[model samples]
Target chain A: MEAYEIVKLARDKKRPTAKAYTKELLTNIVELHGDRAFGDDKAVVGGIGELNGMPVTFIAVEKGGDLKERVYRSFGSPKPEGYRKALRLMKQAEKFKRPILCIVDTAGAYCGEDAEERGQGQAIAQNLYEMMDLKVPSISIIIGEGGSGGALGLSVSSKVYVLENAVYSVISPEACAGILWRDAKKADEAAESLCMTSEYMMKFHVADGVFKEDFSDFKGMCAEIKETLYNDFVQMKKEAPEEIIERRYEKFRNIGVFAEKKASSEKGDID
Target chain B: MLSLTELLKKSKNTIENGGRQFARDEKVKCPACGKEEYRNTIKENNMVCPFCEHHYKISARTRIRQVFDKDSFHELFDNIESADPLEFKGYKRRIEKARISSGEKEGVVCGTASLNKVKCAVFVMEPGFMMGSMGSALGEKVCRLFEYACENHLPVIGFTASGGARMQEGILSLMQMAKVSGAVKKHSNAGGLYICVLTNPTTGGVTASFAMLGDIIIAEPNAVVGFAGRRVIESTMKKSLPDDFQKSEFVLEHGFIDKIVDRRELSMTLGRILNLHREVI
Candidate 1:
């Protein structure tokens, strides 16, 4: 089957979406689950895999297409346990010196009352912080909808790629339009204005690249991804461990700089 | 009855325009100085009264220009657009109208710039842009911007003025709280500094996340900063409100915020703090 056809097939499946994709895309895949602080979350799935015989860690959000499956996977939205599991896997991957490849497709983090009771925010935050300093190369691909913190929890990477039709944003377009105009029908306009598409993200430097939709040739697509992954890994490996850590640190520190004049006045210094 | 209806409509207009009428009316004198001039208040002392030192509200653009180094700021996430994932009713047209009117890509303007030679990443939320709501695109940009900063090893400074999470996005909007907070924690743990400057009307989910997670939290004098509004809390809890409920000073007193610095001194304070954190450099 073609790569696009396989993705379509996986998308249509009711159970084991991540497993299906992994079986097709990877050679030797091993499943790793659980955060260790708590129980494992099935919504987030991670493991070690071989792409063209090169070892890599694969993490992806698992969404159930059917009602039963969705309930089983928590509708692709992870709870605290899910994030913890991802973090554990990420740390393990770093220890093994293998590159990490994350596939983001969740609508957002699980916002159930139960999730909050377990300190969902803290769990997600911990993962994000840990992922930034991981010594291994990391890449994140938005295969579908990358929504909110749930997506971000798995999305800290040196090279981020988005599928042609995938959407990534802070809040969904419908929500913004609804809140601003008291109308949800304006969501298309909101989407256009928001630039949630991969094409737009590539322009803004949010996405390093956009994968071509022509997955009719599954082997070619796989080879291209492998090449891109290798190049990114080679470049990342060139930097010293400390340099890599510092570079990741700086990547987040330099957001949103603007112009302002220095002020002369000041209240008395605080004691 | 007719006059009352007309008065109600006028008042609604005033509210819609974000309390601009108080500045226009000659009878509405400055509470601090008894001055009839409102423009004077806006101009003579950088959105503060020269005579009485009363701090006035500053616009997002004004705040950005005042704090960032001259011509050192470059806008990012200005064009990565938004999409309505739900295709909710009338959401598409309304966003178009907002884009046409606000002349902004979204509620927040994110970029990189130098503050008094101390380079930092900045995000300024414009109340004018859909009340500075956090939607998918806005949330993505904020997260990506932090990622960019983390990669570059620069500190992040945010001037926040949000009405809260955009309700239209439903659960997705609320998720930004965790998303951005996660980013902030990542940036901080990497030895990067995060300074959040809370402006007027910073409330809702935003207050719950990165807005309150700053290593050093600063608010403009008298800015409304809280998780929930005074009226809603009063109604829900059925209790009398305190004199300074949710006000900047009140939050400072309670340790929810570090200090209530006047806007004019914001840039210098931030610069000094960033310089102190220069060990990373």
Candidate 2:
């Protein structure tokens, strides 16, 4: 399939949002609200819940089900407060030794005057900094659009999974097109150039693996995901806290592609 | 041909206040106040306009010389350069052009330097280099610097001036934000002080990572500092923003930055900060 096709599929309004996954995957969930430092952001919905009878902290960017709900959720675009609220829940999870499960789906963070005033960069920075060393096992599954820093704020996890149809990029194809060629209509070409499809992510090792989508049988697909989550957590739980943190650090530490020039020469090994 | 650093040093030596400095023929007009003066005059004033006090966007080498003690900067990781990972169209040429224009291998230059006789690690991002975008090499150098500081028990001083992640390199550029932040966190956890000087136009992924992760975040006077671009926000809101919006002064008023230090007094301010954090023997 073409890269833009996956982009469109990932952005399909009919696709399940994070709320749907959490609803199907967890039971006995107590929804949490507010960042304690600011107002609660409905775009980011997080809570404590039982994952396969194991206590877990759950966080997800919910796009809402309908037009009214989407408007209320800001179409899954989070402000600085949304990231802060997610971090608060993540901290709570760490304090209580609950493993974390984050569901990511967002066009990107909200870019507005109010968001800038509240330090959007700082909020996302704090998440990346804290999440890297969070002591508890954490996993993020990119269900749809994993757009730029917005997606990365919640994805510095022990393991990251990308749904088959999901698309992740440093910038939206439209934005990239507009910036590169001064034309938003060239998004198809930009998507092809961006290497944003799940296949590229797996090839690049940005994500661990791709989860097959079965929207027609949502319950069955979720059951498989739940099993995978249980097994991964059970294994991750076996390691020491320090070990988990170290592994997570290494996962992101080794991501870039660059050559180190030796002292005497100008170029070293690439890859 | 002299290296850029050596050329700067040569120029600094010739242009002492009373020196003939016959090379002062080149004049530059200030972008802020539109006052034209010899380039040496602005350079002598720490790259701040002597007329309007406008902070000129300076190269990383000039920034290092202005902030660090005379001849104290021992550059590190200068050989590390970028590779076009995605082989995106025109990316190779862009990197080549940036290298030539910026006179640096990457967007940032890192090294060990002394601030008012206080030893510390320093990294200055070059705005001339694609607006100091964070590519793999840039992030690796920063991450390595922090790790080095952690091992040596030294404080880190970083001057950030970036547009954001490099789009040509694709996701690897975005990954650099997390990689550098992880390194920054490790250094912080080791109790190493990291001071960030946010310069003009620090935004996007760089802002959301190590730039904002500094314990003491300072900005130059009137530097445009924020996460999203002003144009992006204005377009989103469909309304014109205030003239001072996203300026360093505005960020200070909003309480995100610690202080807005003038370019002339920045070295002294950093020295004071470093001295206060010094280990009491």
Candidate 3:
């Protein structure tokens, strides 16, 4: 299928968005959706698939194109169940020793009163904690807007990549500008300053690389992603499982280090 | 072009002649010395008396700098700006005016710094800016800073002083409490350290989340720290307040804060603590 055709199809709510994308990108894709404690969340879409003949786990935020479908998918924002479902899938991937690839595109985690009552915060926190210990190679790609904890719930990885035009940030640029300056008009400035764009993230080491400049060619994009996945998986397989886990753990352990002047009185003494 | 003695005489004459009678009538007596001279100067010096060692109110910035290394401060998420999600009436305009007036991007500055070469991430809330309210941008920046610290295996230091969550953003502002706390937990589970320094006037949602989750919590002497204001609690409960309610010393006595240190000694104490933690790591 052509890229434009896929884009049009993605905008159509008649069929499953994840199923169509998976069929186009990988072979033998399976759908896995639901947290055992509660009902299934349609916002988060996850499953297993074979990419370039290598087994991999895929997770992405699902959005419905139409109003009815959008409401069904919680407007692409996951509730507590959605986060738990992603966590469950991530753990499954770790257990099977399969490489994990996450595609992030959501406004944020669901912020309804119901979501909060069920420990939305706890679920997201658990995902962050569990992802650090996952003993498998992982990569996260921002295909669209990566918003707040909802996007981050499935975004912890050894390498994080973003589409050229993708925006990834802790909060929406509009939300930041509105809250800080009290003017939604300052959103452009907020976006530039927040380093939400892929180019800026790559410069800051937040993102490893940018994918196809224009996601217009689905076949070509899939091929490129396949090659990248294959290379990353091979490199990850070279390191021992324990070493991989340690490296992944350390990757999250060292983010900001500021210089401090050593105390002169304590400088010379071993004490 | 008046001499110091002439200015003093003029000021004295004005006071004696009742030129500033209204100002003289509103004078606050010093509790420790009973002297009406130079009250603000004492508070500016973290409540330490120049003549005697009487501790007062400590600013959030002073507390953070004291605890970190002399030159090891590197602010993280310094460029992340905030927005008004709710677009509440007059909220945007008021924030713009405040931003220009305060000369700060936001109420809090978060970054990576060191205490005695023990690297840690620190956030200092400036009450001068919008009462150091926690909005979406402040929350995101703080959470991201924690993420950075967790990734780097460093400890975190947060100096909190806020009028509570930003009301201008409505529910979005309140959501930051959970967001920041989640980040703090992730950092802690990664074996990172978190030290919360509560300064004057830390209340509301700020206290409910990361501020209360510090592995080692510290506060300046006499700082006001609580979930709600004294008056509100008193009025709601229909009771008179204690002599030292919500004060740092009182909280310390109640075991909420780990210790109450003078502003001048805060840095040295934090340095020692960081050094000890570094040795353990």
Candidate 4:
């Protein structure tokens, strides 16, 4: 499949949004709202529920599937409020020792003047530190374009998975094209080069796994993901909290390092 | 290089600062005030325009020299070269040029140094080197520095001036955000201090991670500290931003930064903070 086509699929309105996925994946959904610091953000929909009869705290940055919904959710580009709400819910999960599931789908964080005024960088940074230290097991699924820090704020997880159709990039390809080529028209080329496809993410160890989807059978896909997550959770439950945090840190620390095996250079190995 | 006499002759009133787009010149016309000052005078003034207080970008070496005690910074991790991992077009040549132009291995120079006798691990990101973008080389050096600091129970002080992750390195550049942040967390968990000073133009992935995670986030008087560029935001929102948007004053007002320190006073200010915040362990 073309990389640009993947971008389109990730944004397809026909596909189920995070809310729909939540409904399909979890049972007895009890919704939660509001970070103590701010009002609720519709962009980040979070709740506590059961996945395959195991209790879990769930949060997702989702752009609603329809026009009205998408406009209301601001295309899943969260403001500082949304991140604060997500962090609040994650803290609750850690307190209760529940595994946390985060569905990440966003163009990126909101970049409006108001968002900036509300301390967006600090909000995201707080989540990065808190999530890294959270005692509960955490997992994130890149359901769409995991763009920049918006996706990363929710994805400091023990394990991260990306959907086959999802694109995970440091910056949107359009933005990348604009900065590099002085032309946003070259977004397709930028996308091709970002190596943000699920295959590349898994190869680079940025994500733990990729979920191949059968778009027609949404129920089956949810079930498969649930089973996989459940088994992984079962295995992870055996590890201590400190070890889990350390392992997650190490996983991230080792993301992009390699030596080219220089066939014994003239200067020597130490050089 | 133009002499100060010539620069003074073309004073603020005389020079309209019109278009002022000379490609490369030793004389700089202050942005806040149109006073054309010799580059050396501006550098000696800590890169701030003396007439109008407009802060100018300084080289990473100058930044290190100005902020640390005289001859105290023992620069290490200087030889690690960035590989053309993906061999993106002109990337190797660009790295080679950056080496000669910036006089640094990668965008960042990392190692142990002291701030007025308060020892700390220091990493100064050089904007001259491809806008100090983080690639695998920068990331590896930073991660090692944090580990080194943790082992020694020393503090970490970082001065950031970056556009973002190196797009030429692709996913490898993006991973630096995670790698550096992880190393930061390791140090923080060990109860080490990390002071991040956001100088002019700290943005993108660098701002999103370790830069903002500092226990004390100090920014220069007017640093452009933000995630997205002003143009990007303006274009996306179809609106012009406020005059101070993403400037240090704006970021500080929004509680994103703890304080805004003038470049000239950074050394003394940081020394005081380091002494005051030292854990009596």
Candidate 5:
């Protein structure tokens, strides 16, 4: 499929939002709220739940299932409070040794004045810094649009997976097109040029795996995701906390692509 | 938000027009106040408008020369250059043009330098280079700097001025946030100090990463520093923003920045800070 096709599919309202995934995948959910420092954000729903009998902390950027709810949730565009709330929940989960499961679906972080006033960049920065060494194993699944640093706030995980139709990019294609071609109408070309589709994401090593969507069998699709998370956690649970953080750090550390001499690699020689 | 093309055009104009306003022989009008001053006079005043105290953007090289001890800076990671990992349209050309215009290999210049006679690792972003966007090379250089600081037991000081992650590199540029943050986390774990001086127009992915991770975060006076751009916020909020919205003073009032220092006093402020954090014998 063309990257733009995948981008459209990723944004399709018919596709399941994080609400459905959380409800279907996890059991006995006790929804958490608030960043402790600020009011809770409706866009980001986080809580403790059971993933197939195993306790887990699940956080999802929910775009809402209806127009009213979407308006309330800012159409899944998280604010600084939203990311802070997610970080607060993740820290709580770490305290309880519960594995983290983040269901990412957002156009991007909200760009409103209030979001900036509350330090959106700082909130996301804290998450990226802390999540790198979070003691417990964590996994992030991009069920829809995994947009920029907002998506990445909860996505500095032990492993990241994206649904087949999900698209992730540094900037949305529309914005990229506007910046690159001086026209938002050129989004299709920008989308193609961005290499944002899940397939390209995997090839770029940004995504570890792709989960083919089975929306017709939503329960079955969730079951597969749950199983994958459970199995991965069970294996990850065996590793030491230090090892978990080291692996997480290394996963992101090796993400960039650059040209350098073999001997130059050891320039730091920290060890 | 200004488009990349506009930024590129502005950069080209700056280069063709003899680079920085202070680099020219003609008088330049201060953006904040209409007072005009000769380039040499403004340069002598550390690029701050003598009348309104308006801070003009300084080049990365000039920033280093102004803040660090004379002849103490030794540039590192100059060998690393940006590459088109995703083969995005016009990425290579943009980089090439940025290289020629900015005279820098990447968006940031990293190295070891002495501040107030105290050794520290430093990085200053080149605003002339794609608006100091973070791509793979920039990220790698920052990560390596933090690592070097940790190993050498030196503090790391960074002057941040970026639009955000470079879209040309796609997810690779976005990943730099996590990558650099990881390195910062490691340095923090080792109890190494990190100080960030936020400059004009620091926003987006860079602000969302190591820029805000600094142990002591300072902003230059009147610098436009925020997560989202003014236009983005204005459109999203559907309201006109206050003139001071996202400026350093506003950010300080909002409790994000520790202090706002004038450019003329920045070197002395940094010197005092370094002295305070200097390791005990």
Candidate 6:
């Protein structure tokens, strides 16, 4: 199958959501809620968890598994309150010397009138600014779809990862088709044009590594994420706070770094 | 509440007098009001309608000339031509049209300029260039400009006027949001100052990303700044929206915008900001 055909599978309605992955991967998970300023947004799930005895904070956009839950979660399109809640937790993590592991799975940030009225654009931009200076180290993993600013709100960190079958795009192919071709039905063609699959996303240097999926061995996949989390904790805990912040700065700074391809290859730019 | 027909009747009479289709003539009509003024009169007033004070969309080059110190702007990052990775339909043709009409190579133009010799990087998006979309080439230029500012310790000023990401570039255009935001983060962490001036109709991915990351965010008076366009939000939610839903005044009231400046005072205001920043440093 082509990349987007696989994207369909990765985005399967029955596929386990962020909540499922967190349940399997983290120990002693305790979800914290609310932006404190506004009421809580159900779309994002935020909490504290343990990985191999190491304390960590996990923030994720929840794409509920079933039709009913999907409506409840707004299909993982988080409103401004959700992003503010995540920022609130990220600051807490920094103050308490906890590493952050954010799971990005939203189709995009909420664009409803009330959401914009509450400052959705500013909220995401604030997250981007604050995440870079988060005193402690942080990592982000795209367990499913990393959609535009929705995914980015929680994913600007020291390291970023993605599941093997996950897809990330700036704008969804459906919207891109609708806007570009004036024919939303050409979404399949738009998907092919968008370099959204993990394999294609590799060229952008956005995600550090891909966690290979084993459908028959889902537990194995959980184990791998846990292992990576543990390893990051061990190494990141030693670095000085300033060094951690600086390294995180450099990590994000290095994205979109590209150079012209050699004369022997096709004449183009590659990251 | 008034019935829908009453509302339609009320608007139809007004729209006939001043709507865009009714405004085309040797003398341009102001959308904000029913007044008609000579085209030269509007342009002479820095493209602000004299009667209603509506700010008209200005070109990137014209904006640079209007804002910077006389003869002090040096253009950068204009050499890189946008490559069509997917061989997208009519992408090249769009590029050609933008180039011929606007004399700009891409959607965004980046360079160094002086606000009274207090150096800063300026990025102005040309609305004519496919509504100043963020394709890979534009993204790379913006990222590089941010890095340049960081390396040189110069403050940055950005003028955003875009419809959002370039659909022709697909995901590549979208990824620019993260890339540019990352660049902004680095510049900010390095103690560099950045100001973003939001212009008319700044929407979509552009509004969601670096456009909002400025240390001091300013907007043109009455500009429309939001994540989703008006039509999308209305259709998706299946309801009419507030008149001020995406307008700059609403954003200012809601706390995203620091201030709104009139077109005539923008340059002086920027110079004042740059001077104040220097004193603090």
What's the DockQ of model 3?
A: 0.03
lDDT of 1 by residue, A76-164 (tens): 88887888888888888888888888888887777543454464544655565677678888888877777766777787676778877
Cα distance off (Å), candidate 6, residue B275: 2.9
Mind giving the per-residue lDDT tens digits that candidate 2 earns over B143-185?
Answer: 9899999999899999999999998878888889999999999
DockQ of 1: 0.05
* TM-score of the first chain of model 2: 0.96
Q: Which residue pairs show backbone clashes in model 2?
A: none
- Compared with the true structure, all predictions reach lDDT values of 0.69, 0.90, 0.67, 0.82, 0.89, 0.82
Give lDDT: candidate 4, residue A252.
76
Q: Model 5, range A1-271, lDDT digits (tens) per residue?
A: 8789889999999999999999988899999899898898999999999988999999999999889999999999998989889999999999999999999999999888888889999999999999999999999999999999989998999999999999998999998998888999999999999889998788878888999899999988888988888899999989999999999998888887876645636332111
Give the candidates in order of DockQ, highest first: 2, 5, 4, 6, 1, 3
Q: Model 6: which residue pairs collide?
A: none
TM-score of chain B of each: 0.84, 0.91, 0.80, 0.87, 0.90, 0.88
lDDT of 3 by residue, B1-281 (tens): 98654565456434423422343233345666766546555544544776555554443344454466665667666565665443354666766655654545677888878776677788888776788888777777788788888888778878888877675654345446655766776688678888888887777567646676788889877777765456645654577777677777767765667998777787787877777787544
lDDT for each residue of candidate 3 in A137-201, tens digit (9 for 90 to 100)? 88887776666566666776777777766666655556667767788777665564454566555
- lDDT by residue (A66-130, candidate 4, tens digit) is 78988899889998899999999999998898999999999889878777778777778778878
Interface RMSD of each: 8.9, 0.8, 10.7, 2.5, 1.1, 3.2
Q: What ranges in model 5 sit over 4 Å off?
A: A261-271, B1-25
Q: What is the interface RMSD of candidate 2, in Å?
A: 0.8
The C-alpha stretches of model 6 lying farther than 4 A from their native spots are A240-243, A257-268, B1-26, B31-34
Q: Write the per-residue lDDT of candidate 6 for residues A1-271, one digit (tens) a residue.
A: 6866866876888777888888877889999999999989999999999878788999988989778999999999999999999999999999899999898888889869899999888888788778877889899998888888788888888888988888888778788788878888887888888778887667766677899987688888899888987898789889998898778766555444222334453223452
Compose the digit string of candidate 1's lDDT tens values, residues B144-165.
Answer: 7888899999899998888877
RMSD per model, one decimal: 11.6, 3.1, 12.4, 6.7, 4.8, 8.9
Q: Point to the candidate with the largest DockQ.
A: 2
Error of 1 at B133 (Å): 4.4
